[model samples]
Target: MWDLDVQPLISSSKWLQLHGLKRNKLSFSQILSQIGFQHREDFVSTLGKFVASRYADGLFPQYLRAQDGRVYNLTAKKELILHFVDCLTGAIELYKQRMEWVTSESRQLFGVIQESCITIVLDFGTVCRAEFDLCRDALSMVLSQQVAQLANDIIFSTAQDLVKWQQKAVPVSEDSVESAVKWLWKLEHMPAVSHTSSTEALLEAISDETIEAVYYFAVGDVPKDMKHLLLQKVSNSPYAIHTVSFNAREEETIIFLKELSQLTSGRYGEYYYCYYDLLISLILKAIQVGTRESLQRLLSHLAHNKKIKWLNGGRELTVK
Candidate 1:
């Protein structure tokens, strides 16, 4: 006496096949991994998509007409669909509970990044005041106050160094080895008030284990010798260095920073006034090494939410 609408199940089967999932063999575990195993909420959200799709395909009718034109009870089919839905829900709930248990046991583990230290190197020597403003604005929006305070402590001296170097009698050419050595010495030994010794001090202050990340805000060309020395130190450090470039017009500088990011497994971003746009770019870069499945999930979510518009007849993502 158990019966249900056959049409919706038929559509759901077709939908599963269209998505390359074997309908007959579908399981909660498979679905969870497909969505994203790292985040329980994402798994649940994706499961909701399948549920919605089945509902949209008319999964709720109480009766159905067979191919033979005979009216049939849909109670059994409804029960089956409900059972599957319940399975998905139960799985997500169980996973969520487990996550809660783990979180409770390791209360100090979560959000520990906020407690870590990050060094921010501001290239004030080459960057103009306008560029500095942009850097400040971006940092204010993206960084937490604690992190900002850490950055501020080191940034003051680095800025002052640029000003001191600018006022010096000797012309410090970008390629001068003598100038590079002189500034490098100043950066290491000079007091914060005498020179912008922030970089060396920042590097010295952070141990390989204590430092979380390094942010280099570059506005203009970096001297060849200084760049070499900085890159050497960064390579030896355990943490990655993320470079944010502002109005970097020099070809060599751009290439150098880009290569530095790539070699160190760090992120490189060009500062755009639009923080959202910049964030998206950074996210894309971070996930460039992820699996195709991950990319597909992201794209599907973006498409379904209408956050991205398709262009070139759906072959391209429209820049909005």
Candidate 2:
């Protein structure tokens, strides 16, 4: 049965009623979305409060007698806490695995691509040789990983004109990925001149009805005039246009890409070279410190680790 006394607290809470929740039926994602938390620290704080309240009310000295219809002894309370800790630890490990997968390699770049048959447009208009190479490497990783885990086509534009890897979407496999990577390397020797007709690649990609979506990977900032034109052109695309911004020098690029993606009912991802650098550094540190305590110390420096504080809020975790 529901706790009758808590009804008064729920009814009195303006914040709770404001959410329009039908007896707290919201999922974790729904709650976060409704709360619209702006900072990671704020989320951590709120989560800490939740854990603290749950323990204080249910399993501090003993489980709540009214809720369970019997007072749980000290031993029972200890067992319950341990079980809860195990479950929480399992959830954390699962979340960590997913985060590692999502942020690994070109997953960050092509993670938004969910369709089996899709088209990728590479806008290497503004990057130099080094930047172009970086873009190529990232794309190679995507082809290797095959974020969509199926067939796909590629359209890339240089200064001269647009180029296509295949006439239609090809299945993602070991041989196909190797061939695509080889084709990508061939472009390295070409002059990295600015591609003026930005919309040409997009137009070509959309022309293919077999594709389910378009991934527009842009390395540098686009011109204001072209941004407006591209936005107008892609506003009514048949497929979602997921925009990826890499090493964007201008705030306008991020804003425009986000706007474009939102307009096309697509997702957006922004990446920087520093992200890989930081990731590499973290990996190296983990390798250097193989012990559990050292690993925890290393992770403690990360902002995400602030979650550990909340997950163990007001609980003394004795390692025995």
TM per candidate = 0.37, 0.59
Clashing pairs in 2: none
What's the lDDT for all of these models?
Answer: 0.44, 0.61
| Model 1 misplacement above 4 A | 1-115, 144-202, 205-209, 274-320
TM-score of candidate 1 against the unseen true structure: 0.37
Candidate 2 per-residue lDDT over residues 6-124, each given as its tens digit:
22211124423543333443443333333232121123564564222234343324433354343332433446546545655654554455456556667677663456677777777
Cα lDDT tens digits, model 1, 78-185, are 466676677666545544543443333111111111223454555544443333454554443333322332321222214335333222122213333234334433
